[model samples]
Target chain A: MSDRIFGGIGLVIAIFFAWQATLIQTSFISDAVGPKTFPILLAVLLGISSVYFLLKPDPEPDWPRAGRFAEIAFAALVLLAYGQLLPEIGFVIATALTAGYLAWRLGSKPLEAVIVGVGTSLGIFVIFKLLLGLSLAEGPLGF
Target chain B: MELLASLGDGFAIAISWQNLLYALLGCLLGTIMGALPGLGPSNGVAILIPLAFTLGLDATGALILLTSVYYGAMYGGRISSILLNIPGDEPAMMTCLDGYPMARKGQAGEALALSGIASFVGAFLSTCGLVLLAPQLVKVALLFGPAEYFALFALAFATLGGISAKNQAKSLFAAALGIMLAMIGVDTQTGVPRFTFGEVHLYDGIDFLVAIVGLFALSEVFIFLEHRGTEKDATTGPRMEIGRITPTWPMIQSCIPTMGRTSILGFISGVLPGAGASLGSFVSYSMEKKLVDRDGTFGTGDPRGVAAPETGNNAAAGGALVPMLALGVPGSGTTAVLLAVLLALNITPGPLLFQQNPDVVWGLIAALFIGNFMLLALNIPMVGLFTRVLMVPPRILMPIVAMISFVGIYGISGSSFDLMVMLIFGVAGWALRKLEVPLVPIILGTLLGNEMEVNFRRAVTIADGDYSVLISSPLTIVLWAIAIIGFIIPIFVSSTLRRKMKKDERDLTD
Candidate 1:
């Protein structure tokens, strides 16, 4: 059951946190309680609750695995790539690509997505760079 | 009398051509963002924070714009719920029960009218409460110390299990995850890296804006993908006839009580961290259900049902400000974001706020009055207009929202690095949604993480590592007791609900 798994995971996480806190050296601010105290307490609580959940599982069904995984993964990667790529291409191009890809994934036709993407990029460029006058990169691919 | 004089000065500053423009811009953009399901006031502010910084507006002017956006979004949230049975925010969900029903029966215009009126009433009434109560609250907040603050944080965290999810442990896990994430970055007191893993950017810790976008906006995108290819037929309801958009006199009179009670209840709830407008709405709905039920009219187009939560949620938005300005503690996620902005502005909110920075305080108070009226006027004529926004396809809308988020972030740092972090978190946030872990805690954690750590450190140093120092002070002891009570009572109540649910199922089976 999901509760059992969640509880087990929680317990492991609590233990890991407890271990991490051990490395935190005590100081004036850390004092007698130190950084480790609260985390250790939380770890124990998590460990206890996880065991309790294992003993008494609820009957409700877990959320269905909608094909959301693929969309989320790809879109996230594109966003990460966009961030890294923004300095290479200008803000407008990088933003347009990011928007275009997201739009397509959201079910817009390619042409529609591209148009929206470009429109968004231009809109942002006008607002932040031109109107607000925030200095942004004009990269290798000029604005 | 003095309040009026101060208010006059506030208006003088707020109504200046420059400030009015910022207020107007914030209100318009805020309404649109708030109307989108899943994006609330916090993100609305966080996404645009960098812009405020870039513009370098006077602190008062910037605050007015962001605060307007905050309330404007609260007003806009009602649109989606009334029209499409989709709540723009969780608090708006109650409105849908009666609002959408009314819309289905060809009274879409009337439903919009009622929600707008209720939102205005809630906002107006609570601002009155703010003017009256804020000073007194600040005086009380002056007595608090590190122990009390920690206790307050604990109490706030305690409420998560009550409202966040069905599983209490999961909520606790989420809260712990938040606490740990808050612990990330350099330890303020010791100058040691807690969880930075040597990432230079992270030495400053996870930015709340990046975390918030990931938790709310990006996670929402992922959730939207789940409901992908599952578009319902565009809402088909009666076309409106006229502009006499007033509720029946009796209906209006009845809602006055609901409005009054919800405003008070909402303000009190908003004064507490973790218990937000969403919870206030839920609590008000259930209370109204118990109090004003006769023929099951509460849900089936009974206007009171729609009005109660609307009033509660909106007033709760105003009430949430009480702690932020008075105590320097943010009572909800949105207020947390506002606190970050205040910190960025070099304006620390607390008892001294009233004496040191009366302009920011009075300006905010005065603007609440102006903003609420503007929102009402805007919401009424624009009801039909806002409904048309829902007609736009997700493909187009998503790109625009994403672009704004991306560009707004880039403008903040003027570095591609921040954008990259935003993307990484956006994806991780989306993925976390599938796992059913709540995202708000992650944000609340990241925002409050450093503050909580620093406070605990301070308490320890003050006590000279005498562990008992955390609870030695009377204020600390009282807060700790409250925190303990807050944590325990909810678990028991939820467990009781779960048991009752099991019994009901068994009876049905038999």
Candidate 2:
């Protein structure tokens, strides 16, 4: 994205935050400034900064193209799915699947990726849960 | 004498088999992390905090391990900078200016040895400074009131903001964003939910570990993915045939004065609240270049060039701890992560830390002493082994790093919600990186935001809502002056320097 568009987004966010800051409800009858003070001040500062960026946009950065964006988005999806499945499927299964997929995406062969993924997942679980005695989410099969 | 006596007790704690083992493990891991490009001390410490907690180590033992990793990484970063020309971390960037040249010339062994010894000298002397000066500094810290604290934090924000990013306004914006994030949960004084948006988890503040893991580790994974197939083989150059790992007697004697000068310089820089190892090493390298290498041989395999930055950075790491231990203010990103760990362990690090938790404080100091020694011992014979870490393909490494981050955050909060938070911040952090906004200020803003607010409120309360109370104290006035000057002087100096260079070019052309 161009610096102009980025700065525009920042300005919108800053203004929205400033409006939200005005909405914060304060119940304290203290002599000092309320909890709203800091946020409001921060919003004003951010708004000013956004104006500066809007006025003097930076040189165009080397952003990734579509192919790389797909890679990143896929990786992010894998992580998000991993988090969602963690409690349901357990640590070992969820970790192995996600890590294996990621490894494959990084150019590892299927078998090698699976072996590494499963091995790492199980190894970490054993170390953290068994040896260290920290509890990890268990699968229905129970370890 | 009292400091000596306390240090003796600290040694007793640190010398125990358990603490010693922890220190060794930290050093080993720190070296590996530091040797790897893109996994510096902050990431190393952040990724390990959950593991430290899961192991159920007490605060003191955890700190010893974590801090060992901190300085050990500083020592290990030189390995890659010398062998591969790619700095493993920011401080090591200066090392690459001279170190890679030395390696290409087949003086890799000598360069490695010089850097190792310099790192030891820097870390050791700064640790001595920590022991002697921390107590006195702590006494002075006790005199600070809310107004003074506000000014001090402002100074921290100003100096830190000015030093980090090229665009100071962008740095300040990032800091403001961090403070906004910090204010998300319920307000402590008013019991008002500020920005929680009615989420149940929002009652408690955002977890620092979660934010950090997302910001440093996961975003790093995204960045790694972007350049996965494009990595040049770091080991492709000349086969590094290091003869003797140790510097000869004459070589050691030659570096003594340079090491001493840079160590002191680095230590002072480290003690400042916003000046970190990168600045320390840069200043030391440039000063040495001007003083000794007048003929411009500093970057062309000069041994003193390697020695200066290596010593300066490691010394600065040790020096950075002084402010964190004495005043509860972190000087750099790594130390800010350390401060988070201390808070997670329910230990507040400030003036009272010395009086209340002497064992933790003293034990950490003693551990630094041992950790530095262990790093030197480990770096010499093991230097070759560490260089091999550069060979780990980003494909495999990025996934492992991501997995570690996932498990680490999961282990801490045990909430999928928090994991989601990490993922969101990871994307945000990556976007911010693309925008050229530095990440350090965000973390600093989050860490100090609450303290700044509390102190601001307290000062106002004391003066019956008079805003002038903030500038009433002499100490606060001085701090405010320093803060303003710190922000403006850098801009003025840089602009003047640019103008002078332009004039010189015009004169030459004429």
Candidate 3:
């Protein structure tokens, strides 16, 4: 089930943390408790919790089926690309693309999604960047 | 007399056109967001923080605006519960019990109006409670040493699971994960980098605000995607025609005592670390049922049933500010976001906040009272308009939520790196939520992790590394005992109180 998988991941991270804790080079003038102690303590807590999940896995979590999961993955991909594309495409275009695609994915008509996208992009740009004068990426538009 | 003077000063500040305008705006937007299904106070505040900051308000103005949103959202959450049978958040779940039933009986308008009044009663009373109680709590808190502070932080993490958390292990695991995340960046004391992985951005540690927006707001988008159009989307927001907006005078008279009693009860629950509004709502609804449901009419669209939870949760929401303001600990997850904003502003919360920034503190308090009256006036006439939020389906609404998170994070930091981390947290947050791990503790851990580490070192140094110093004082011992009990007892107790709270989770997931 998903519980054991999560536990396995948690335990690995906990061990990684504990190992990293030991690797921390404490300066000579550091206080009685250095950086390693709290992290090590936290690592142990994480390890114990992960073991609980491993030994006492709950019922199988109701994960979505293939198509829905693919949709989620795609949206996540869009968001991932969004972060990368922001500085390049600027906030307006990047936002429009992400917003439009998401709206379309959310069951909007193509034109409506595009409107939502462009509207969201420009709306935020005008309000935040223009009206409020907060900093946003100018990209090519230089607005 | 001193309290009155300070509160009067607060009123003087809160009444300014700019602050008043901000308060009005916050209440309006808060109600709109609160009525949206799947959005709660945490998401509401997180999504809108950029806007608050973008407006170029001072700390006092910003706090007033956001805290007004906080109160308004508590008022708005009932809209979905009554009209759509979907709660905006956990605290609103109790409202759905008797609320939707009343709506089905064609009393949706009455239900909305009644809950609004109840919310007003709860919020107004609790804001009064907060003004009277918080300074006293601050006096006691000033006695805290580093050890007691450490114990207090531990207590916060231990109890943050609240009544809705199904597993303590999951909460602990999440907290540790957060602490590990906090362990990234350079160690300030030793000048050693802990887990920088050779990235310059890692030197400042993962910003909690970025993490918050991602985990709460962005993950919400991903969750919407997974359930987008399948029968997994069965929990559709079905709107009821909100007929007959006002409750009869007799009905109001009947419920007056219930509101009065539950206000105090909810405030006490809110003041308790980790209990928050959900516990407040649950306790109030159940307690009222016990005392007055002799005919078993409590859940069958009883006016009192609708009134109890609304008031309790609202009161508890107001009450939750006590710890955050007095002890530098959050009373609920929503307050945690507020606390993070405070810290980001370099305004330390706790006893010193009262001493150093009395204007800000008192202004915020005065604004909460002002917000309470504004919400009552707003929710009554505008309940019909607020109900319109339920009509906006996930597809259109969700993208807006996503855009806000994207734009907000970007606009605030202008750092794509922060946005990138936000996406990771969003995706990872979706997975954790699906696994039933609570998100609040993870946030709390990150928010308090550095301070927890600092207090740990301070305590150790003060006691010359005896380590026994943690339990040396009575306050420390009491806090440690509470932490242990909070972490361990719920697993064995498994009371009906917890089971009923779980039922909401099942209904939600179903």
Which has the greatest DockQ?
3
Instruction: Please state the error at residue B190 of candidate 2 in Å.
Output: 2.2
| Model no. 2, DockQ | 0.70
Tens digit of per-residue lDDT, candidate 1, span B1-510: 887788888787778777777777777777887776556677678777766866787898888888889888888888788777677877787787777767666677777788888888888888888887888887777787877777666765666444334666555666667777667677666566765656788788776666665566655565665565754322333343333456677877878788778777877676665577877776777688778867767666678878888988988888888877887766666777787678767787877898888988888788778788778878777777776766666657766767777666776667776777776677656544545556655666666666676677677777777667777878777777876666666555756654553453243223
Q: Which interface RMSD values do the candidates have, in the order shown?
A: 3.2, 1.4, 1.3
Candidate 3 regions with alpha-carbon error over 4 angstroms: B232-237, B501-510
Which residue runs of candidate 2 sit more than 4 Å off their true CA positions? A28-31, B162-164, B231-239, B294-296, B494-510
Query: What is the per-residue lDDT of model 2 for residues A1-143, given as tens digits with 9 covering 90 to 100?
Result: 36677778878888888788889886846447888777888888888888888888888888888998899898898899899988988888998888888888877799989977997788878877888787676767665
Candidate number with greatest TM-score: 3
> After superposing candidate 1, which stretches have Cα over 4 Å from the reference?
A1-67, B1-8, B160-165, B231-254, B272-275, B286-296, B495-510
- Compared with the true structure, what per-residue lDDT tens digits does model 1 show for residues A25-123? 656643455566666666676677667667866564435354555656677778778878878887888888888888888888999888888888888
**Candidate 2's residue-wise lDDT over B1-510, tens digit each?**
888999999999899898899999999999999888788999999899877886678887898899889887888788888887777898887898778888888888888888998999999999999898889899999999999988888887777743533677787788888888888888888888878788989778888778888999889888877766654434344456666667778878877889999999999999986678987887898788778886767778788889999989988888888888888888788888888788778888889999998998898889999999999899888887887777776667777888888888887768899899999989888888888887877887777788889999999988888999999989999999998887776656645544543453243223
How high is the DockQ of candidate 1? 0.48
Q: What ranking emerges by lDDT with the best candidate at the front?
A: 3, 2, 1
lDDT of each: 0.72, 0.83, 0.87
